[model samples]
Target: MKNPTNGSLAQTFQTLEEYNPALNAGVEKVALVLQTMALFFLIVLFIIELQNYAKKLNSDDGGLTMEIVTSIGMRYLVAFLMVMASGEILDFIMWLAIQASKWVSSVLPEGTYNMTVPGIKGKVGFFEKPIVFLFSAIAQLAVWTNSYIATIIIFLRAIQLFIFKALAPIFVVFVMSEELKSIGIGFLKQFSAYALQGVVLVLLMGIYPALMQNDFLAGDVATGMDAWLTNIGVFFLIFLKALVVLVLIIGSQNLAKRLIGGG
Candidate 1:
């Protein structure tokens, strides 16, 4: 099969050619448009909210509405940018991963197996093919995307934390004024922090550790114990990570309540 972007730049500038210029440009364009649109709405929303805040702030004993909104908005903006960057980074990882797998297969394998990736078919020797494939897959999906995803998750959790912090004051009043029976929002804010924190921690903490033990890490013999260990290790790693995350959710919410005074 022929290379999807460019064929066999392998002999010259091997790594360079693997990057698809056309796709990169396209991805960049889309990201730019999204950022621009998001910023536009953010600014417009900020202006409107600010105006509303101005009117209410002085009327309500001139409280800290302006400060709270400004701070939360800044956090929201940062979280949004991080999310977009995470997306672009994921695209790069996906493309490079396809190429890396092929390269490894070619290097180690003395012509053991064939890999037809991105619609391009090629023969990979047994010498290093398995490791190559494992490495490529692990690095591309499990590492590159994993890290950014973790960051995204963290920032997302932060965003939720910020929102809850912003709302805690309002909810207290709502509980008092609207009857305890109608305090659904209060309960939601209390519980939401726990749920969000666990998710972020699991994605970030467990991913790389699992990747480190990958079959790609060393040796051939993808048979017997090696293969079983790799598969089982991955499962347990993720499970443990998830457990850590759960601890964080419940724990962090309590911490946040004490430190940041949020639900």
Candidate 2:
């Protein structure tokens, strides 16, 4: 009997497939490289935007404030685009890994079976109608018929750092004109940033590889892009998470020093 406490992860661990030598390494390498490039570019772009923003805000140029606002909005837009692109790339990689595992399993000396991928997407349910109103109140009233694009644009404009910088910290003062307090400001900032992160990733996780049919990583099996998807399974993703953690730890220390004034 399986323990409920062990959770789906236990199943995942138990089910890790052993694939053909050529397919496994090939898919993994391709996934790893593509994922690494995407993450690397995201970090690099974030840093670039941050520096540019710091300059625009602290500069005396008359147009600096406007430039900063535009830049921030566009950063979100670009970030959203990149995130969407990455998802397609990931799907391609995963699909390849699964197919390779299937092909390899069919020909295994011992004869293997039981291959499955764990992914679940719940569609709109009857009970979810009430939530539509909640989202709609916050969501944009789009003029364009392409609701997705409008939502993305509206969200970018409304939730970006520059807009939040102006909006999140208002405080009522009896002594003088009102001032904005920084209380709860950190939460708001993080929430908006994370919201953007989720949407970006969701978009990328679906459509990326369609853009590059030849992008799969199965080198041994690929004569053309038919082998573009990878075979690494989830190990490459595990490695990427470690990289993000390392980066966050180092970046947090630097960020803390900057905020509170000390290294």
Q: On residues 122-239, what C-alpha lDDT tens digit does candidate 1 reach at each position? A: 3344554555455444434433343444445444543443333333322322222212315534444443433333332332232324333442334443454355444434434444
Q: Evaluated with TM-score, which candidate comes out highest?
A: 1
Cα lDDT for residue 129, candidate 2: 31
* Model 2 Cα lDDT, one tens digit per residue, 1-263: 21112122111111112213454344445444554454454555555666666676668553445676576557555544534343343334334433433343334333111111212112334444345333332222211112233234333422332322222222101011112223333433343342233223222221222222222221244223222122222223323433443344224324433433332
Q: What is the C-alpha RMSD of each candidate to the true structure, in Å?
A: 16.4, 25.2
The C-alpha TM-scores of every prediction are: 0.30, 0.19
TM-score of 1: 0.30
Clashes of each: 13, 16
lDDT of 1 at 65: 61
The reply for model 2, stretches above 4 Å from the true place, is 1-25, 61-263
